[model samples]
Each structure stands twice: as C-alpha cells, then as structure tokens.
Target: MDFKYVTQEERERLYNEVWDEPLKIVAQRYNMSDNGLRKHCKRLWIPLPSVGYWAKIKAGKKVFKPDLPKVRGELKRYVHSYAIKYRSDIDKYSDVELQSMKGLSLLTDGTIRYVNEICSNIEVKNQLRNPHNLIKQHKDELMYRKRRDKELQQASFNTDYYNITKSKYRENKPMIPIYVSEVNLNRAYRIINALLFAIEEMEGFANVMLDSGNDKGYFVIMKTTFYFIMMEEGKNKSKNNAEEHVPILVLSLSAGDEYYKCTNYSFKFKDKVDEPLEKQIGIIILEMLQTANKILIEEMLRDREYEREIKKKERQRRLEQMRKGELEEIKILQQAASDWNKAEEIRKFTNQMELKIGEIEDEEKRHKLSRWVLWAKDKADWIDPLIEKEDKLLGESEYIFEEIIETQ
Candidate 1:
C-alpha cells in the first residue's frame, strides 16, 4: 500500500478544509475510517469543530473555531494510509489472523442461563414502609424552591444510616438526593448479594463493600471503583393490592478523579411483590457487570496505547540521532562531488584552450589564454585529491551506520 508523509502544518490545513464537513466524508477523502481520522486529530492536539457548529453556521448564528493547543513534543511525520475492509479480504484471511481480529467471549451460555435461573428465583417480600417526616419536609422545600427561585431545590437529609444531602464531590454536578426506605434497604441488600454471586460466577471474584457514607455501596476493580446508591419510592400497594409501586435505585458510578455520576432505574413491583426480587435485581446487576467489564477493558486498552506511543517516540529519537551522526559525512560527499564535476569541466576547457594556443595569431590574446589555462590546470590539480577523498568517504558510508549501532 502507498502512504504519504504529512507535515503538522499540512495536516492542520487538511483539517481546516474539512472543519465544517462531517468527519466520515473527510475520512473518505483521505482513504481512512472516520475513527482513524478522529484519533489522528486527537494525537496531534488538533481542535475539531464540536457538535452543532455547522448547524449554527447554517442558521446564520455566529460560530467560532476551537483553538488547537500547542503540543510540547517533536512532531513525527504522519503516514496517511488506509484501505476499506472488504468481504473478500475476510475470505482470504488466514485462520490465525482472523482469530486474532475477533473479540473475546465475554459471557458463556451457561453463565447466561444461570443468571436467568437466579433472577427467576427472586421473591419480593411485601412490607408497609413509611418515609420519615424529615424526608417529606425536604421534598416539600425542594418543590417550593424549584418553583420560586428557578434553581435546583434539593433538600438535605443526613442521618446515622442514610444520607440525602449535597455532598462534596470531585466534579461539580447537580444530583437528586436518594430516599431509601426501611423496606427498600432490605430489598437492596438482597439485590446486592445476588449481584455479588453473579459477578463471582462470571469473573471469579467480587470486591463489593459498603461505603463510609452508609447509604452507598462501592464495587472496586483494580484502580477503578463503581459506587451506587439506592432509594425507595414512598408510595406503597394498598391493602386491596389494586395500586402498584415502583422503587427507584440510584447507581452512582465512581468516575476516576473522585467524581461520582448516578444512573437511576426504577423497578416496578407490578403484582409480583410476592415473587422473589431476584429478576429485578438480576437485570440491573447484569447491566452493572457489563458496564464495569467495558470500563476495565477500555482502561487496559488506553494503558497499552500509551505504552505504544512511548516506544514510538523512543524509536524516532534513536533514528534522529543516527541521522545526525551521518549528516557530516553526507555533506562532505556532496561538496566533493560538486568540486569533482567542476574540476573535470575546468580540465576539459584547459585542454581545448591548449589546442587554441596553436591557432592564436594575436600575441595579446594568446598571452591571456595561456594565463587562463594555467589557472584552470592548477584548480583541477588541487581538486583531484579532494575528489578521491570524497569517493573513499562515500565507499565508507556503508560502515557509518554499523559503527553507530555498536557505539549505541
């Protein structure tokens, strides 16, 4: 496949040409995938237009370009090359190569079947749980403030066990306070236990622990942790079992840098409150497990990518050093070749003048020609040794790289 080495400035120009165009279309022009172009742009610290930028321009609204940040490392030549994948290539691929390109088997049929069986066995116990007066008061205050101030009016409810107060966090974000009822706490534990078993079955082990906050739980995997908080809806099924109640479970994930973002899910108890809570909890836990697995894989891929970049830079540095070592020899040979060509031309001209000396009739002209011939002969004689030295040096050029390698 052919490739073109693009300079940083040239890359920037190409990016600008497609700044307002869709990345997929631009990638097609460059014979690469959209994702490949995006990654290249990211690696080069090139700023790309954000979503809605072109839309804003079409709407006649003012739009601004994002400034590219100055990177602190030496820019390497980007070899732009790619080929669109075709079905024929897959057919032509060797079994080993095709196998290497395939994704890992994340879940087994047995694991899926087991998870489903466990979920089927979950029995939800009916309990008449009421919210504390403080919880009610907080909700009321939140509603009032939300209506009056046009700002988020979340009420604070911190206690010995559960908390619903605005807590300090890494990334500043608005969050709704969870309301965990006495009944839901019991249900939450059952859900947690089931998830632990499922994760253990799938991944061999689980490291889930209750957080210091008392109301939250955390599942740690290597350097990353997934934190979650569950809350109960105050409404309960009537004595006649005519009304249905759904409990809210807030799963707050610990995004690195101490940031926690919550994903909320509500489990409806339909008429199956007597049915074990396994199924409801199983579905949620399965999602969490899938998400956690994805996060872990992404982190691993990122670490490998970083290592590759470091190695690439190191290789470039070594190559640059080798080139610098040979640069002087290369310059000397170039200069020598130039002098040799000039010397040959001068010698030829002097020989032709020698012939002209016999033909000259005027004494003044012959005298001037003789002086010029003497000067040319002297210049050619002086350049002969230098030309020989350059020829020898060119022959020795092959060994220069070997010596550099040995020294390194």
Candidate 2:
C-alpha cells in the first residue's frame, strides 16, 4: 500500500478503526505500518484510554474525572452556598474576632510578641528614642536647620546639627503621643493576621526549612522586625487623638557567603486612617514580604549555579592544556631519536666509501679515482649541513614545546 498517497483524513479513519485491535492485526488489515498507525492515533486526539480507565469502564462504573467547567461551577456553587449560610456571621465579625481565628491567631500572636520584645529591649528602645523617635519628633526643626545651613553656605560641618538642637530647645516641645481609633487598630490587626496566615499556607509549598533549635530563621526574624515596627506605631498612635494612624512595616534579611542583604518585606497604607486600621495593611505587607523572599532566594540559587558551571569549565580547560603539553613533549622526544638515527646512518656510509677508495691501485685509475674522491668529499660536506639542519629542527621543537611544571 502507498502510505504517502493517503490523505490525512484517510490515515485518521484507518487509525481509529484499528485502534482497538492487536498491533499485528491493525498493521495487516489497514495495509499500514504499526508505527504509522500509532503516530496517526496520537495526532487525532483519539482517547486511547489508560489501563486503569479501561478497567473502570469494564466494571460499569462512572469515573470521577472532573472537567474544568464542572469544577468551576462546583466552586461557584460552594462559595455561594457558604455566603448564603454564613453571611450574617461573616458580616457581624469584628476585626479583632477575625484576627483571632485559628489560622490568623498564630501570625497575630507572633507579631505581637515580636513587637513587645523589641520595645522592651533596652538597646532597641535606646535606638528607637535616639534615632527613630528623634527623627519623627524633630522633623520640622531638622528641616529648618537644613535650610539655614544651605543659605549660609557654612564650612562648619556641625552647623546644621547645632541649629537643630537650638531649635528643639527653643520650642519647649510637649510629649505628644500617637493617636489611633479603636476601629482602625482592629482593622490593621486583622489585615496583618490574614497576611501572616496566607504566608504560612504558602510556606507549606515553598520548601523553606526554618532553622532548628535556638537558631533564628531569617524570614521569621525579618517578619518579626517588620511587625514590631507596625505594632509600635499602632501603640504610639493609640494614645493621642491629634495624629492619624497609618500602618507601616519594614523588614531586612541578610545571609550567605557574600552576606547578601535584602529588603525582605515592606508595606504602607496609602489611605489616611481615621481609626486604627491594621488588618489590611498587615496582610498586604506579609504577602509582599514572602514574594520578595522567594524571588531573592531563587535569584541567589541561579547565580550560584552559574558560578559553579564557570569554575567547572575553568578546571576542564586547565586539564586539557596539561594533556596537550604532555602529547607535544612525547612528539619532540620521538623526533629527536629519529634525527639521531639518520645522522648515524650517514656517518657509516661516509666511512665505507673511504675504505673502498683506499683498496683501489693503478695510476690512471687512481687519478680518475682521485677526481671521484674529491666529488665524494664535496658530498661528504653535505652531512654537516644535514646534521646542522637536524639540530635546528630539535632546537625549534624544544622552543615550541611548553609544559606547566609546578615549582616546589
């Protein structure tokens, strides 16, 4: 049968008809090669059911294969059913109550603990008061000092600092606490809690191995630090009615041989907070942090693998150069032996000719022989040139041969 003459449709029809038959039978009946038949079946999208599917089909039971549309409809129905059944429960839930949910509780508690610990720590407290709080409290004073310094074009480096301190003392600043409404605080907490739970869920699939024992996991610590900053802001704002609350988080992570540093996570609320709002801000921050960490880790791994490949290639190239040098050395030694052999052969030939000339007698014959002897002598001179040429070849060979020899 001329398989090439067959159209695609004909091939597909032939494939389907013999698809259920034994391979040998199909090949014979269709007048087609077994491989051709198989290829045709694959192209046609014919359901050549797996053994498991066939067994189930034979048993007269419907298989539980979920189609995309059916699965999507089922999901929609499930979500709708839940909405109908628990609409009131969901709507009535306070932010605090939502944050207390099993999944959210773990994250909220972790963040709260981290914040409290940081605030209570003497060193951290000092840093906060001297740097962070100072920056916030004396923002206007610092700005004024900066402007004055610029205007004066002063050479003194400490002029700006002196002006800021002077301005701060002149103001007689009252300690004003941060203010946050109860509603916003609850919201912020809920948002953060939700974010933490989402991150934990993702972590299950992320293949991140947390440090064992007392060793702090970089990501965990980073999250803790970020949460601490948010919590501190929340607490400070809770006391004063004048300042509006805002959710903000910052995190840093450092690791590896090169001490690669990264902003592990950060988030801030763009909207003004009329009340304490933590939940949404917290959740957004947590999600961003996890995403950044994943990207950083993947990038680091890819770079490390590329570096390893480069080192491997360098090692292979060195080995190849070493092998090449050894081969060239062997060739040079062989060439030298061959040249010496040729020189010895020429020397023996010259000696034999000399011996033959000595045995010849007769005046005319001797005279003619002398002329031949002079010609032979001229030829004998050629040996020196040949030997010189051989020496030159050896010298050139040695000059070209290079092998890396390690010095002690």
Off by over 4 Å in 1: 1-105, 108-179, 204-216, 220-226, 234-279, 290-337, 352-408
**Which regions of candidate 2 fall more than 4 Å away from where they truly are?**
1-56, 59-193, 204-277, 281-294, 297-312, 315-323, 326-334, 341-408
Q: Judged by TM-score, which candidate is best?
A: 1
Q: Write the per-residue lDDT of candidate 2 for residues 217-255, one digit (tens) a residue.
A: 222322232222223232234235648553433222332
lDDT of each candidate versus the true structure: 0.51, 0.41
Candidate 2 positional error at 217, Å:
6.1
Q: Where's the lowest-lDDT run of ten residues in candidate 2?
A: 78-87
Instruction: Give the winner by lDDT.
Output: 1
Colliding residue pairs in candidate 1: 122-276, 122-277, 122-278, 123-275, 123-276, 123-277, 124-275, 124-276
Query: For candidate 1, lDDT tens digit of each residue in 1-408?
Result: 122455434655766856768788888988999888888777666677888878897899998877655323333333221110112234354434443442222334444465556555554334313422323333454455445433223332325212323232122222223456655555554444555444433322233232452334344432235554433444445546667555544433443432222333223331244543344555555555455444544544555667889999999999998888679556655765776677788899889989979798999999998998997686575665342222332342223334345545
User: Any idea what lDDT model 1 has?
Assistant: 0.51
**What lDDT score goes with residue 165 in model 2?**
45
TM-score of each: 0.35, 0.31
Estimate candidate 2's alpha-carbon lDDT, on a 0 to 1 scale: 0.41
